[model samples]
Target: MNPRATPTAPPAPGPDSLTERYVHAVTRRLPEDQRDDVARELRATVADRADSLHDAGATDDEAERAAVTELGDPDRLAADYRGSAQQLIGPALYPAWARMLRILLLVVVPIVVVVVTVVDLLDGADAGSLIGGAVTTALGVGVQLAFWVTLVYALLDRTLSRAEAEQACGGPWSPDDLPPVRTSRGSVGDLAASLAFYALVAGALVWQQLRPPVDGHPLIDPALWSFWIPVLLVALAGEAAYEVWKWRTGWTRRTALLNLVPTTLFALPLAYLAWSERLLDPDAVAAIQQGWPDFDPGVAHLVVLAVCVVVWVWDVVDGFRRAA
Candidate 1:
């Protein structure tokens, strides 16, 4: 009789099986230099685990599924093997990243869209062009904001130590940092009003130049159109952007300090112009004098300067009060 042939171990699962697919998923994410070794090791480990399960009375298909399931998500496993983080911004920096992104989207994006729309409207663009310009501006600004914000946070996540990252994200949270709860509807209305006021201010600045002149002179000094008027408009735009940020973030000492920048930009220039008697066009002033003989230019200048001082002080005070 022929010698009895010893039964050899069963061959490992085929390439198309669940175990092979799982191995592929994991190795694909790994570096090319590490892929071959990792794939071989992973495949052998999975096959052995599956075989043991099968011996324990699981069917071949059930064993293969169980082996892969026990390994968890392939993306996570790949990250483990590479010794890298699984997130763009880790938990330490995520809150700051999220808050910054919200502020940018809520503030910068709308400002960009509105500016583009207004420019297009002033150019007498057709309705289609106006809508398209606004939409495109919004999308472009949003994409830029997201990419840059993510890249910055990702770099910080990789390069900074944990303590450094926490500090960079404004340090550990405290009860004092918590914002006072306010009605959401009221906040929304306030934001809307602030935005609208800025829009009107911007529109008025441009409209003054476009409107028919009174007595051969614009209401504002024509010389101002060369520099100071544009500066004022830019300052107003900055204020508008800050207003949106403040609305979202609520008040803080830092924000209050920042508020002084745009306020000074606007008020200082006006005050200087008023004090030097260069604010109104001489022709416009003459026309006004003709209508009201008792109008005093000196009194008007003083009144304008006083109003600027009062408004600037009130705004600065209000910001700190809200923060407190």
Candidate 2:
């Protein structure tokens, strides 16, 4: 073809123009290839919106300008569209997993919270104590929400992308993303938290066994003491977080695992606490004895608790490696 055969192109829209400006604003927030895809989607949405306005009596140019104005500044809109909320709800709300989470939280959390609050009140807790407890509860919930919402949605987006690509390429989820099954191991902080948690559970079990019983039967606190579990769990989690910081490493997974180790350890005691409080199971946990000959379940429990502590420490450290 001749060099002068093709007509010259028109100059691009001015910086002042609305549609061009809007597209430019949000596109930069997206992935390179997906940038164009999002831009096109936005464009289509704008065009359709503008067309509807025109049909409702606005002039064509006025409608287009209105759509552009509705989009607002490039930076804010771009940042919001690229945020974690979009990946979580704007994208996943329709997914089965997302719906299940909504149902579980909506139905379960308030009931549990109310019951716990009532139990706390009946235990002769003062107004000042309840107010302080509420504040602490709110803060703990906010932290967990901040962590899980961001991480899970990001993970979900990544997973979906991989799944889509695999469908196109005839592949499966990659092994690299899956952590290897290996022996558990952990850091100093993890060891401390695990040891502390187990030591505490062990201590609690021992204290119960040693406490003098009423009429040869163990005495129980009957006002539904299971409400204390969340407060206790939060305290343990904070300890785990401190341990993660203490064992600072190049291995992020180890830190995360250390974090989870506390959660698991906390759960065991929390479970035992619930059982003791609700079912009033006296024989469930027993004190450790130097000499044991008969079928002593307490011995088995003590062994399990000890094993959990050791594995928890290792788990915390190896969680750093991520191949654990």
Candidate 3:
């Protein structure tokens, strides 16, 4: 008698069926930022568990149970996704910072837009002029936004990457475990360059005061005369102070921040003074040529020079000490 032909077919995967469905459902629901990576990692982890279970002689149904069990709970898994490297600055914090920055930009941007539009409109602006001005203003804002975002994201990436690498090597994840940035020390050449640069600026200010090439009379606002010289003096002093700070600290945050202060102080104060004077008399642009002979730009400036001298001396000593 012919034996009944034995049916040979792959076994139905009951456990895998459930696990696969669960994984797909949960991964599909994962927040967009972490969805891709979470899905990939979870897939591999679950599959590996299935293989191990099969080796242990468990049925497909049982194997799926073990694998899903090993994966932990779905809510926790998604939360991990949020906190994971997949979401640096995290799902939560990133959104908040973005919101705040956007609000700030939007608020300031509208005011800028109105001012620009008014200026353009006053300039007999046609469609082209108005659109162009608006577009240019928007572009400027966009550039600033891009800069801030790029900087923030870069910082997040560096900090997170380092943390992950450390943790992967079995070290504890410490946010403060970040590596310190190396500061640049000014060589003798650098020191000479710094000194020469400030000296030139100082000389230029002197030239402007003694012999400005203005055919029009100078505007004698106590403020205008009071402005540039002291700022120049402060800048000179700031440069020296920065050098000293750098020498002592080898160019750390202190040096960088202190160095940067003069730029804002000098430029911003000058801009504000021009604005104030312009506000004092917008129609009298010619009034700029008047002299503030009674105003002592020189005296205010001498005090500024004294401050700078102090800074310079400190820097010379500090630089030598640090270099030593």
TM, every model? 0.67, 0.31, 0.28
Indicate which candidate wins on TM-score.
1
Error in Å for residue 141 of model 1? 2.1
Put down candidate 2 lDDT per residue, 72-153, tens digits, no spaces: 7767677677763434433432343453454334323433344345446657689888777766665565556556755665
> What is the per-residue lDDT of model 1 for residues 164-220, given as tens digits with 9 covering 90 to 100?
998897787778776545433228788889879977988877787678367666777
lDDT of 1: 0.81
Q: Please give the CA lDDT of all the candidate structures.
A: 0.81, 0.53, 0.55
11-77, model 3: which lDDT tens digit per residue?
4434457665666667665678877776777766676667667677887667768888877777666
157 Cα displacement, candidate 3 (Å): 6.3
User: Model 2, poorest ten-residue lDDT window?
Assistant: 2-11
Worst 10 residues of 3 by lDDT: 278-287
Per-model root-mean-square deviation over C-alphas: 6.5, 15.4, 15.3
Q: State model 3's lDDT.
A: 0.55
Candidate 3 residue-pair clash tally = 8
lDDT of model number 2: 0.53
